[model samples]
Target: MKLTVLVDNNTYIDQYYAGEPAVSYYIEIDDLKILFDTGYSHIFIKNAVSMGIDLNAVTHIVLSHGHNDHSRGLKYLREQYALPNARLVAHPLCFRPKSYENEYIGAPFSLEEINRLFCYQPAEAPVFLSENCIFLGQIPELYSFEKRKAIGTTIIDGAEREDLCLDDSALVCRTDQGLFIVTGCSHSGICSITDHARKVCQDQRITGIIGGFHLFDTDSKLEETIRFLSDLSPDMLYPCHCVSLKAKAQMLKYMDIEEVGVGLTIQL
Candidate 1:
């Protein structure tokens, strides 16, 4: 499997690709071309073109959650590529209307528009997109330190309720070494997501993890999270997007954390 960072919150000093406070990863596994979480704007498209990646060939577009930063790029993506054959995969609630403090923070497209644009696959259970890649559906709470937290309100059946981000999920790629996890903001909690990935894949070893951890302050939760990750001892960790530098600094004391940026590529 190979993965390319099409959009991220940072860019290396010499690398000239665009950056945004968002996430978008282009992954190739087996014969499948998957795009995980479009960024907040058209930056993903620009970065992809710079990387010489043909977005039109993407076979699957998987959304990590309904948050705008993770999913709003769909509007820009459709403008350049038809992607008639690609399938849209995400939790059923990922396309609903969501807001935080009276500001929209959901996918740019609605469920109806998504259904009309591509082959939509609403999955609440783990679904294998390829022999080595599996889209982890709704993550279950597996850790006490990392519990589901509400970010905003989402409309369900015409009623608004606190969004626990039940739609948030991740993708796991199985390899000889272990599992390589690709996630969005990890509103579901990175440790919880990792545990769920291990349970679903039935593998204890994790080779690496990339994408947002949503950890900010260097609080007790960060300490416990670092301990939890230290126990797993994954080969590498690339926590970006919503993860704060202070949290990254705290994590650096215990584990290997790679710097993620646009134009970064990893082959495994």
Candidate 2:
């Protein structure tokens, strides 16, 4: 595997990366080097070192919720990347208290500021960061009609949240070209995060499904999310941060779609 798109929202308009948006994404299976979510600041560490990407070889940092353009790039990767031991597979209530109320608001910039340099492995459903990846937490809603709406549930400095408890997750690999979904904004509802990553990576074939499908999909959640991704008939389907454009034209009207922007690159 090998994925790039060091930041998105649509930019990388050819001609050598013109303009930018930075939403972060930089996976690389086998000797893994994940870093899915850390944009909107140092612009995903300066477009991931100009697309050569190697921020101290991050091991993991899969946070898909606690919005703020996805954890506000942990304040420019705690002041210009270095990792020292990067490991932050989220879902321990994804740092509680969120916002988006009157539109795009937030909370989650404490804990001495994201532990200064990330490392908080809290999960809920499936853990394992190796043996062929797997970091999906709290993605156990099991769709059945997907419904998770917590745009912003406040109450900090004393706990108590409303539960957008999104703690969103995704990162399932079984390679050799099979189940390899890796989201960060499907927000626990991209067919219930690919049917809970095929029942916690029991795997059954699903080659690609990259990041962010969050745009509050419609048209029947985009026709039951493409009939559950055409029965996991994956083979590549990378979306990007806060998917929109009318929920990706209702998921490209049910299949065939790929475009993550910002230095887009992918392999498997």
Off by over 4 Å in 1: none
RMSD of each candidate relative to the true structure: 0.8, 16.8
Tell me the TM-score of each prediction against the true structure.
Answer: 0.98, 0.32
Per residue, candidate 1 scores C-alpha lDDT tens digits across 56-161 of 8999999999899988999998888888889999999999999999999999988999888879999999999987899999999887777888888999999999
Candidate 2 residue lDDT tens string, 1-268? 7777777777745526533443567888778798877765667776677776778888788877666676777766867766868888777667665655545444247555566546776777688778887887877777655687665565556875665655777778777877878776776687777767777777777778877777654767667776777776687887766777777777777778787677777777
TM-score of 1: 0.98
Pairing residues by index, what is the TM-score of model 2? 0.32
Clashing pairs in 1: none
Model 2, stretches more than 4 Å misplaced?
A: 2-26, 29-32, 35-56, 66-93, 97-110, 118-144, 149-159, 166-180, 184-187, 192-207, 210-226, 236-267
Best by TM-score: 1
lDDT of 2: 0.71
Task: Indicate which candidate wins on lDDT.
Answer: 1
